[model samples]
Target: MSERTTFQDQPHRTVLLRNGTVHSPADPFATAMVVENGHIAWVGSEGAADSFADGVDEVVNLEGALVTPAFTDAHVHTTATGLALTGLDLTGVRTLADALERVRAYAAARPADRVLLGHGWDASTWPEQRPPSRRELDEATGGRALYLTRADVHSAVVTTALLDLVPRAREISGYAADAPLTGPAHHAVRAAAYDSVTPAQRAEAQRAALARAASLGIGSLHECAGPEISSADDLTALLALAAQEAGPRVTGYWAEAITSVEGAARVRELGAIGAAGDLFVDGSLGSHTAWLCEPYADLADGAGQRGVCHLDAGAIAAHVIACTEAGIQAGFHAIGDAALSAVVEGVRTAADKLGLARVRAARHRVEHAEMLSPELIAAFAELALTASVQPAFDAAWGGDDAMYARRLGPERARTLNPYAALLRAGVPLALGSDSPVTPLDPWGTVRAAAFHRTPEHRVSVRAAFTAHTRGGWRAIGRDDAGVLVPGAPADYALWRTGDLVVQVPDTRVANWSTDPRSGTPGLPELTPGGPLPLCLRTVVGGHTVYAGPNE
Candidate 1:
């Protein structure tokens, strides 16, 4: 029998922290803090710490480190993120030959009979700018069941052996020779590959991913699991782990478009916040499956073929209504303009059916609404949706000469992921890495938003940081959790920072100047091209889940 992992209950005690710059909402430069009963008890300058420390159970000197609330990754695939770390990682293969060589090396290293699973291959960055053909992958893997997903997770390249094993794959749509499998075919083949992995392996992968999140100073992560991304059993195991551990908290999102009474009942039993996130309204742009306003500029085979739209207005409206009535958040994975348009109409329909106040109070969410028309943006604001976004998308494939430009033409490409516009419209924004798709780099994500390629859409550093930290808590209706003031949850990170500088958009795109009037203190310098802070410790609910050398 597999042993069940159980977390020991922790008894709270008073602990005093001193000689550090506290990045609290109340006081940014506070040199002392007191945590007790699993919550922040006091925060002040060092002058008043001695009195508070007099009877505390323990006293810790922070040694001048920076203290702030630990990050909340608004969207993540837990098992997949962890598996990527332990599996063949092809994050930055610069040439086609390099990719082929890596595949060859990886396949040789694995057991002869074991199926090979890998992710993070973007042909756009390579010199050839193309993925390998099925025959090439079959030659590389020697007929083993091999599946290498694209960087966007929207499509994948699989060996013929794998396709033969998945007999249904041949009957599914979106199957093309020498091209990545997308739409239904991609989903089927991908499922078959992962289905071979044992439950123990899945558990281990989740544990590995959660450990990484803790080490990265993340205190909470929303598991965006669904019928498409993962099974109900996977979500259960993950939520169980988070509840029992002294680690990053997990808020679950089961992505499914509710179609029937049975489906609504199943969603409530999934042990998640809502049936939202990655319940695909559309596919990703990288795979040419994202529901776009017009035909992709690079489309060669299918003349005038726009991307796929999985859900129409009626389906979206039905899902939204069911979720709203159930008192759970409703969201969709929308990247392109057509998808966002569908989502907006759905939300509007739900509001009309179930009073706008009821819908707004539910605080429904939408993931990766990357392309939005002004009308759609206004609708999102009116519906009060949380835009769960990944800044690294723009950082990696957002430049004029990058993949997005090639896919949608330069003018249209530059219009995607309008962070400032969304924020200015009073829509709540939650930033995340989307894990294997980007990476679990919170500071890197912050930098990307502040230094967007299009200067006009860049947000202030504080706003970007707030969106990442506080916006995540707000995403799932946890308004009291993200901030670090007295009476808040004792969840935070300690960092070893360097010369602190603030960035502002100016005449030269980035002025790299600190503003005295801003009243913010000592954030890591976020120039267009700059370094990020290294986290030394991470604390969740007054418990240290990760401690670096200093402890």
Candidate 2:
């Protein structure tokens, strides 16, 4: 571990990154850049370096790697993501048999005293659909197994023996009355199972997650969870993990679903410590519970489920108003068009009731505005809602004629990740990996945004970069991030590429790269393949927290 040292004690003080093209974003481009005390002091040509050579401490050669603002995933579940990183990953397991084999192997290696837990197995994506049961898990874990949760994190599969250990699991919220465990009841057991892990174990999981994020050059994240369901204790535990003397910086959005002014007050108190509050207006698309105008084309149970509206229209309006009045910004999770509409109404009603001028001043936002009618595009801008989207979602599943089309059909499928449309409509676009749901990689995220499955909706590489970097910071109401300008935070990522021309293009036009399947030279520059594209070095607030061996 590196010692915590002051800038004065460090060998490098006035460092010159000369000859490399600096994409200040504020300016068209600069030839070189100078970093002093962890902030950009000057950006110009290589000749500008000589003027400060007398005061120079160390000089670094760019070697032609693209230097840009480090990414910040605006919406992420840090603790869950961290645990997933260390647990038995069945994320890619196709069959129930495949999942069982992995669980059995994991259980074989564990001690009797240890309670086995794992994540990342989505039944929705599996060939043998519906979630597994306790009986199946019991067989998988031998006799002493406690396998919990698939990808959604909203549900889990626990062995009978494991459920016996936690007696309350026998009667959980979302579980079916006749069944041993199912639905929200199963989720409650999963949450309780998570709580069973000691603070020390939880902290370790968080540490592993932050380490991975640092390696990927993600400088910040928003931790979203329900209020009573996903308590402040969870956020505190995650913050404790990131609070290590050596770790990347982290900001949080505490997603509490409470609708009272008192609930808003508690969230406001959390904001004093840099945590934002999040609300869920609807369920996820995969679950087929997102409130939509029309029924899902695939599921013809009529309009399908209209989604879970936990609060009434008036209550929804009150919650937004309460959060804003308490001086805390709110984020609403609205995955379906109907949910999006409800959120829009809530924001508008809240604004109208509390004066639009003052409401805009609060900067409240709507998270995951994924599915929306064309008519609602302008409404998002009108309501001043920030679209907290996960670009990596499209990259993995939204390939041409893939799962999205299968789930949403053709017409609705076209709107999978409408980056360009939202941007043009003046909706503040922010990028998030929603880790656990998707891997957290900025380049892959940019690739997804810049090269959408549907070509027309694709955004420029610069525009995608902005969403992942600056737009993310703005999503959380901060301007200090995502820039290389003077007085900005000394946080940036360096990617070694063969030719910087493709990445740092002259014209601002969106350029579609060769297919990822093709062995194009450009792909290797961003994704060096081995060890997740080596972070090189990660500095937060002018202090180096992570330095790769390649550095």
Candidate 3:
């Protein structure tokens, strides 16, 4: 295997890809595309491709493959995802004992690690229904400092030794002697753990993550980094690596609250696109920290134990106004109803003060957005707020017997992730994996949304596909990318697929869309149990980032 050349090294390449099914709005039945100088110069039928056949520098015979715009994961934690890929992953450990054993073995295997870091443990499914205790973790790792985060990344169970690294963590609001830490405590411990990672290790993890994404046909990624989630140096390093490599394009969002133009400028200095991403308005439901209108059915702590609220409506309003004035996108991580309500109130106040058009023009986004009301859905459309969502969340924790139903009652759980409502109400949707929380499976994500556990919330596969692709580009205020149209950036993937067909949740619409006269460019069959298309090649800005198997 030879080292792959990056787009930066081959800036002016001209290539023609022919004999493939091209999914383009410009030509629904197209089977060819021409790329020149990192942009789509032309896209049409096989006959039209003949004119450019003798003129291109290189010609790729796609051999009847399916070509579509490469996917854009709207929200991701790059370094964390990489670490999970290269380190201990407790994603499906059903027993508490198994999780502990995995931790013990992992610790023994990596004896020289400064701070042991791992993710994706959900105690909700454990028979004991509890996370490993600090003492248990101490014994598991022989008192080694360890930070193991929950699947949601909102909380963690840290060894006492790790807590000693951050002495003030004990004073944080959500800290407890034995229970998993939340809020400031979790953030503090996570920082200490990640800070222990050397620059070389971090770079290797990031490269592994980008390579995995490229192989999965992901052409762009929205890095959701923050002071609490990840450090500024981490984001800078990842961005530099992406810029210097041939992998997916990475757009970084630094989740910091801004109250002045100076703060916004400082965010720009960090090489971030906006002061947005995982700006926590609240926490996650699994951690029992998401701000809710009502108390959790499972917790009997008190009458008013309805999750935690990190930011009030006033603080949210201040940030929105500041970001809007500075011409930067602002976003919040709001899951529960109360947190979402605060976001709506704050954005509405900003709209009132800055004029609706000015505020809406900023196109600020909200992450997760799982627990939404009809009113909130309307508010998102009115304010032009992009709902950066993860359908995998629904697939993982939804249904009557899952974690969501255990947290909130089954009825309320069914209402979570209202994709159909959001789409019908005209809210712009950008799909993501929130990788490490859920694995990055683009076709699986589309299937999850189309075949939602709660049927009423289901969206068409085409709609979900668009949300994962072009919607991500639109979220970052780019309209010229993430599509197969001429003049668009040449970021696309070639997939060895079965047959292209229209798949929709609604039978009436499915009947119409499947008809040839509808002119809808078909996608692969995304039935729940069906196999997804395999990527043959992935190109970013006209350069091949990944060529699978023998390609």
Candidate 4:
């Protein structure tokens, strides 16, 4: 295979993509697409492709590959994803010992002063049911520990060395009045770990992650750079990395608490407004920190702890008001029911206090309406709040008798995500991957949403596609993205199996592409036997940012 050329400047390059089945996500499903300088010039049958009568400069047959609007992950920590791509990965390990072993191996491979950064270790699922302590890692690293964080990013377990490097960590905040920096303070230590990384190293990590995302067909990502930890300079580093044109388009979001009038002004000065970054009303369920009305099912404490509310109602309302007053769009992380409710209340309070028209104009949003009651789902449309969620999370963990189920109990777990319910209730949906927590595989996300592992939450593939594409563009107020039609940005993904069909198996067994060692029926993984399907030849603004090797 020859290396594909990335055209930086268009020299009358009128390329015609013929015979491809296009999922324009528009009314049409299959049609020839014409590209002139990167934007779709026309979309119709070869007969109507005569619009290219100006004479095409180049012609390539799509060979019936699926040409769909490229996916936009509505929520992700791009810098974090990039770092994890090159650093240690502990995503699917079951025991704390297993996690420590991975970190120990990583530590052995590198020398001291070289900060050990890692992600994707979920303490909730581990039998230990708690994060690995700094002391445990201390032993693992031969007392030279500098391990940083778990997967949720909500917390971190740092060695004494790391704590010494970040003295502020000594004054950890956000826990009960008595406790030390063990909880959210660990998040601070994680921030310190990021500082240890050089700008060049961070950029390289970002580039590698973008390459991974491109290989999986993701063209754009919403980088949720939390302000509580990441300072303006951190965001600057990320933006500087993003400007490199290496892999995917990065849209950044700063944390809400830090989005002060001055901070909002700085972001505008930094040229980050009308883009990414927002506040968190609550934490995540994986951390058992999501603000919920009812408590965890298994917790012995009769009084279930409704999830954490990082921002008080007044602070949340005030911030929303401030962001709106400044004409900046905001996104809030709301996973649990109570947290979602609080954010909704905050938005409503902000609007009512500052006037609804003004708040509506700002279009400040709520991210991840993961566990919505029917009432809240209805309110999302009324409030015009954007439910930025990761569908793949549902397919992976929201299935029958899964962790989420055990946490929320059957009723609540079954209703988690509720895409069909939300859409039907008129909630505007936006899809994201929440990378490092989940894979940035756009097709897999679409597949999960389309084929709801629980079946009850299944949404049409078209709707899921729209949520991933158009919905994300709309969420960030990008009019040109998520559309392949003319006059829209020429951002799209070209895949090999656009029309591949899948049916629900009669047996309720997980499909593996390869035969399972368990020797169970229908247990072979559903692997595409042919060439890699859904390989991304992603193009943005007519520039070939990423192309599959097959090209």
TM-scores of all predicted structures: 0.96, 0.87, 0.97, 0.87
Q: Kindly list the per-residue Cα lDDT of model 4 for residues 1-551, writing each as its tens digit.
A: 23334333434467787777666634354457877775777776767766674588777677866677777888877767877788788888899889889888988987754578887877667889777776777788777647555566665666777666767767656433222133457666666777778878877777787778777767778777755645567676666666655556777777745446786776665546542344667777766678888887756544436657777667677777777777788667778888877777877898787787777656566776788888888777777777888887886677767778878887888878888888888777889888877878776777777667667677765677788989988888776768777777667777765224432322355322222342211100122232335574877666667777787
Clashing pairs in 3: none
How large is the C-alpha RMSD of every model relative to the true structure? 2.3, 5.1, 2.8, 6.8
Model 3 global lDDT (CA atoms, 0 to 1)? 0.93
Q: Model 2 segments beyond 4 Å from truth?
A: 1-14, 112-114, 145-147, 165-173, 176-183, 228-230, 258-262, 271-278, 300-304, 399-401, 502-534
Q: Each candidate: what lDDT?
A: 0.86, 0.67, 0.93, 0.70
lDDT of 4: 0.70
> Model 3 has how many clashing residue pairs?
0
Candidate 3: tens digits of C-alpha lDDT, residues 104-149: 9999999999999999999998999899999999999999999999
lDDT per residue (tens digit) for residues 52-129 in model 1: 878899998889888888999999999989889888878987887888888999999987536798999999898887
Least well predicted 10-residue stretch by lDDT in candidate 4: 519-528
Clashes of each: 0, 6, 0, 13
- The candidate that achieves the highest lDDT relative to the unseen native structure: 3
Best of the two (2, 3) by TM-score: 3
